[model samples]
Target: MAAASLNVENVTGLLQDCLSKLGFEVYPLKVGWYNSVLSPSLRLPFPDDSLAVVVLSTPAMFEQAFLPFMEQRGCQGLSDPIDQCVKHCATSAVSQCFPGQNVDVRYDYELLPSRKPKFLAQTAAHVSGAAFYYQQSDVTDQPWAEKKMFGVCVHPRFGGWFAIRALLVFEDVVVGSEVVQPVPPDCVPTREGRIQLLESFNFHWQDWSYRNIICPVQTYSQKQRDYFSARPAERFALLRTWGFLPKEDHQPDISSDAQSEMITHG
Candidate 1:
């Protein structure tokens, strides 16, 4: 496709048409919006006005895309099953939508030689107006003091039940001044509400109460929650018992750092 043919609307529309029914959401943002939030060293190596799209998975993805993917293509080697499913869906959509385009695709689980993520998932989601990323700084009066509290993204509709999956950069597609950045909705706007959110996320994440801060319209199904709650090794065992993963597949369990780097809320 010609560069002139690609704009934020068509690019995201193509991705949405492909991924939305499979339970994914696509949001478009300029490279500058993402780069402007981070320091120089963390900036993406793209023209400021380059078109980029962020992909997110909602609760329906488990039933809509993942199970079907597993049924058709089962588990392959030791990689995370969810990661494999997401890559399959995202890459296929990109290739099918724009056959010859130069797209710089980055996944949430990928890391640079510097051990940094290819792109900050939450930041991308926030800038793309997919979800509101609430960090410790977003809270006032400093409740944690010396202790550090990690940040989390809350989708207006899905709350924390969604995950930012991938970022697609259209290298040759640049948008003019007409495109404007949209601010992510501030769901947990109150100081007390923000406090509860951070505490639930940092200290009691296992309970998943943080995800309910905004009273999401939908949440993960019981089966989906069960899958995410298990440890990575345990997840493999569960899949095998369910006749999805083959028994002979001895993909070694991922490390703690990788666990922390998962594309999931796990």
Candidate 2:
């Protein structure tokens, strides 16, 4: 069930304090902020005042969270190891920080029955002021005419070096008008820059040049890049090279859905 009415500051501050030390960032927004920018069918089914927090993984997440998680727990099932680690960390944080509360946790990797993402990752990031989501619509006199170019969020500090990990909707916690929405930084302000950024992400994403559109404060390490560079299906072998092993009984497999998600945005 939902918990008693809670303060947004208390909840947001609590999550930040708990997560920041582990290389994650949290930004709080009302559910309405996200819904306003999406189509009706894509809207989250919640009250306008419902408190939600978007979680992002900075470059440090690999060393601060994933490495330690692998060392302690190992991959337990037929799922993406990175997904598993992020889930474990997010779940543990919610449980410890707000026991018995009804927070609807949605991971970026999770799909609904319709196969759509449970929550739009970039939309949540944008609405929460965590990152500026640059889209084809944002660029006037578009270059990719008649083609649907997917949007990507760029962190003000991390640029494209970060990932939107999850959304935590505090079901019972509501906020008033005092909780004004913040605008995400316009990191790529020029039309020319936006066009270049979109083209790199859409056509040459494999080269990862889009991630360097702005000078990032920190970026993924070579070790992290090596890991993400491999195909998702081949990750089991890569993990083995890192001294991690999968259970013998289970096939060293990841779902195609998971694989597509990683390849498209990874």
Candidate 3:
């Protein structure tokens, strides 16, 4: 699988299949080419004119396949369990498909603490080619930066339930399209009140709620709401029993500085 010989359609299909095998619902949000030099804020590992693909994916928990797969794997635990699982599955799939190709596999969460790259910022830059802004208002006027919320981007269908799973950077491929289009208005905020929207929009599990601006029950299925509504202990147990948790010892301890850094830029 040489990078130059990589077919976009083929590779995209392979990725979708791989994600499906790992119990993820693949939703390819954007496909484009990026020149890293055009965006100084994004610290991407790849060079200019790299082909980039951003996916908005969620753990297909409601699907019949996920629970069985988890049961088969046996369970362990991690801090960001789902993200870690997706990272592992994505890395394996990419490696198997493009053994020695010049590709970079990035995740929403930093798997390797020693190499903490800002994947979210890089994804935003690749898709939008502008300095990534967390505030929707700042980039709301910018067409390229559509679908972006505060720090994280939201999917019209998945709302906050999904994760920005992977960003595949193919050095050899260059897509012709450079124009960025606005995402569907499904998740866009209304003029009722911006502050109120942010206050209720909870991405963390600490105080999870589906009533936020981004979360419309129609977009996120009733099944997803039930999954989130589960007690934390029960959820953790289920994830652990199904081998979704990261190894206890493998979890990284974030220093105060690192924590602040993630908060500042995430």
The number of the candidate with the highest TM-score is: 1
Score residue 211 of candidate 3 by CA lDDT.
Answer: 31
Worst 10 contiguous positions by lDDT, candidate 1: 257-266
Query: For candidate 3, lDDT tens digit of each residue in 84-110?
Result: 445557677778877887766666655
Give per-model CA RMSD.
Answer: 1.5, 2.2, 7.0
After TM-score superposition, the amount by which residue 60's alpha carbon in candidate 1 deviates from its true location, in angstroms, is: 0.5
What is residue 7's positional error in candidate 3, in angstroms?
3.7
Q: Write the per-residue lDDT of candidate 1 for residues 97-142, one digit (tens) a residue.
A: 9999999999988989999889999999999898999999998898
Candidate 2: residue 56 Cα off by (Å): 0.4
* Poorly placed runs, candidate 3 (over 4 Å): 21-41, 59-69, 75-80, 111-116, 121-152, 177-186, 202-207, 210-266
Error of 2 at 195 (Å): 0.6
As a whole number from 0 to 100, the lDDT of residue 18 in candidate 1 is 98
Against the true structure, whose lDDT is highest? 1
lDDT value, residue 59 of candidate 3:
35
